[model samples]
Target: MASQVPPQIFSRRRRIAGLRRARVRQAKRDAARYILDDMVEDVLDRLEFIRMSPTRVLVIGDWTGTLALSLRGGGSDVTEHDVATLDEEHPVESESYDLIVSLCSLDRVNDLPGALLHLRNALAEGGMMIASFLGAGSLVNLRRAMLAAEPDRPAARMHPLVDNQAASALMQRALFKRQVVDSRTLTASFGSLDRLVSDLRDQGLGSALANPPPALDKAAKARAGAAFLDTASDQGRVLEIFEILTLTGWKN
Candidate 1:
């Protein structure tokens, strides 16, 4: 079947270079980049819990390439694929990989179910798939700010998030045995909204909607900043919530 997702949504042209630049900028600055690193660490921690020692592994959407590095460090054979190299219809040989880990990438796919099915097909029996992405309820504060900015007529400033329930069902639809879906909320406090946005850009978390809304006017931007500040806590910093959803399943 043809993919329902439009190829332009991800705009893979120079995507790898863009990700590399983002990580470089992140390292040069002391700003909070722990979200991406944290997500990778969390995936590793989960692997440790399962006591997984797979000889063949695949790391998808690893823009920073850290996950592949870590897996190779542990003496596992790892192949890295990112948005630049993968599409919904990418072919996979059955029972190819004993383990697959995807970080911060699946949510942007146009054909999520098809992608899941492909991943399931690529896994060996009892091989595990661990994927994480921003889910619904993420960027609540930012959404609110964007809404307040365009009070007259709201525009699409961000991509829609995948709900956890729907994600779990997708696992079943993909025929992943022992499927599980879970979420966690990570709150990031920023002194200003611009800093928050900068942090997002530094992590390659910018909007990837097919038809992104027009850039906000200067006045609207100011309004958003004010709205964000209005919600600041006693510590004088605004809080933004990032709902990280983790999907786990095994091919049995």
Candidate 2:
């Protein structure tokens, strides 16, 4: 039996380019890393509560390298890799890592189900995988703004994301034991839509569509900016919501 290939909705090259741009951008400016930070904290907290000390660990998307640094301090051999160029088909060494922690990357993968399977395969029996990424309810403000920009016809401004239910289904299909899927909401305030976009780019959250829509025209840009501002609260800031989905599973 031949394995089916996942649809090519996202372009890994585009995402890698965005990550490269973010690396340089971060060096120049102190960029917002809330999403990555939240994921790191969640992983750390989970490890603490579970009281699991994995010696062979793989850390992905630790852009600030802080997660890897902290894990290494615990006397673990950690293999770090940028999430941008990870090939879902061959994500990691098979049955090698005792623990795999990937942050803010799964949402952009073209073959999400396949990616989960590869992650499960990479784990030794009973080894655990912890992954967190932006989920379905993320970027409400941006989504509204984009919709207002093209009232008649909207462009593909963002990638479709999985919710907790879809994540749980994927875990089950991967045959991971003791699977758990959860979602957490985080809020961030921005004075302007432009600032929100800048923050997203800084965190390597740029669009990774295979054929991204062209840039909005001047009028559309103005409309979008205005629409985004209209949603600002009394505090003169727009509160954007990010729904982070976390998946925890152990290889059977």
Candidate 3:
């Protein structure tokens, strides 16, 4: 059989643009940005709790530079590698770093298993790697709204996310020596659908699909808005949940 090529699920150009967009919006964070705040804070707390003090550290997808700065402040030499690439000559050099923390990037990768493998390859023996990203059970309201927008046949508007169990399986498949996976749910209230979309865009949650659906027309947009409104609570606020899946493991 001929070798099989991995289908393109995300556009590299779009992914980079999303990250850059998030970086620019970092200064004007809002309640929606609590996703990143919760993740980064968890990474820091885990490092402290585990008492793993590595001299060399690598951070990926840190739009705000907070995590890397904290690591540096703690006396760990830090490298902020924001570029997304996985190859033999990867900038992440094999067995180079003592610890690697990836945030909000893996979910956008075309080959998540391959990405995790590359991350593992870049770690020194017994080194640790922790990654966090938006996972399944997130954006249920947005999805429902999009479906209601196109009542007939719905087009794929967002990427499929990995749940906690799937994340754990991926880490195991990545051949991590020892791994643990868990998820956290962060919720925010929005008064309108447009506000929710704006918040997602501002926090690096924009569409990076290889074949995104065409822009919604006026009628569809109105329907989607109405659908989102249907989910609002008695207090007239829509509660949206962001499931952040975290995986922590050791390099064999």
lDDT of 1 by residue, 1-252 (tens): 983554555544444555666767777657556677888989889889988888899888766678888888889999887776666446565467999888888887767888888988899888989999999988888888999999999987677789988998999999999999999989889999899988887887876666767899999999999998998889989878899999999998
Order by TM-score, highest first: 2, 3, 1
What is the model-wide C-alpha lDDT for candidate 3? Answer: 0.85
Question: Tens digit of lDDT per residue, candidate 3, span 115-213?
Answer: 888889889988999999999989999999999999998899989999988888989998997799988888888999999988887778899999998
Error of 2 at 188 (Å): 0.6
lDDT of 2 by residue, 1-252 (tens): 998777788888888898998888887657888788888988989999999889999887888888888889998899888755467556575568999998888888877877888988898878999989999999988999999999999998888999988999999998889999999999999999899999999989988899999999999998999999897889889999999999999986
What are the clashing pairs of model 3?
none
Q: Candidate 1 — which pairs collide?
A: none
Global lDDT scores for all candidate models:
0.82, 0.87, 0.85
Tell me the number of clashing residue pairs for each predicted model.
0, 0, 0
Superposed Cα deviation of residue 74, candidate 3 (Å): 0.8
Ten residues in sequence with the least summed lDDT for candidate 1 = 6-15
Q: Point out where model 2 deviates above 4 Å.
A: 1-3
Q: Report RMSD for candidate 1.
A: 2.4
Model 1 TM-score, 2 decimals: 0.91
